[model samples]
Target: MTLPSAYTEAPARRFNVGERVRVKLAFPPGHRRTPVYVRGKSGVVERVCGAFANPEELAYGFDGNPKRVLYRVRFRQRELWSDYAGSESDHLELEIYEHWLEAA
Candidate 1:
C-alpha cells in the first residue's frame, strides 16, 4: 500500500538519535504495534525510521493519516529482563512508533 499523495511532507518528528526515552506502559484495547515486553522500559533512540501510517489504525481498516514518526530504539537486554544472564553490552533494538514512547 502507498501513502496518499497529499502526504508529501513528513510529519513533525519527536525524539532524536541518542535521546533517552521510555516506552509507554499503556494497555489500551484494540490493535497495537508496541510490544508488551518493552512497555515501561527505558532505551535510547538508535535512529529515526521515518514516519508511516499507524499500523494499529490500519489493522482496523481506518486510513492512518497524519503519519506517526517511527524510531529504532536500543535497550539493554538486562533492562528488559531481570533474569537476563547475557553480557552487559547486549542490546536489543525495536522499531517503535512515537506514540508508544515518552521522555525518559
Candidate 2:
C-alpha cells in the first residue's frame, strides 16, 4: 500500500544523470549522512533517487522540513583509492544528499 508523504512536493534537484559532481568535504559537529572517505571525491550522477526528509535534522528531533534531493552517484574505484587494484571499469555507487555535493 502507498502511504501519503508529509512533504507536498519534492525539492528542486541540482544535478542530472551523467553530470560530474564533487562531494563536499566539510565536517560539522553533529549527525551527518555523508561519509568521510567520499568527501572531495568526484563522481557522476547515476540517477535521481528522489527527495526525502533531512535526516541530520530529524536525528536532533526537528521536523526535517525542506526535503533534500538524493542521488545515486557513481565513482571510479581507482579514483577513491590510489592503490586500488581493480579493473578500470570498477566503480562505487553511493546515495548522497544534495547538500553534500557540489559542482566538479
TM-score winner = 1
lDDT of 1 at 81: 100
- Estimate TM-scores for all models: 0.88, 0.87
Write one digit per residue (lDDT tens) for candidate 2, span 2-88.
134343333478897789999998888899989898999999987777888999999999988788898888999998999999899
- Candidates' lDDT values, in order? 0.86, 0.86
State residue 14's C-alpha deviation in candidate 1, in Å.
1.3
Error of 2 at 79 (Å): 0.8
Off-target runs (Cα >4 Å) in candidate 2 are 1-11
Please provide, for model 1 over 5-97, each residue's C-alpha lDDT reduced to its tens digit, 9 standing for 90 to 100: 332233478787789999999999999989999999999987777889999889989899767988889999999999999999999999899
Which whole-number lDDT from 0 to 100 does residue 73 have in model 2?
Answer: 87
Candidate 2 at 31: error in angstroms?
0.8
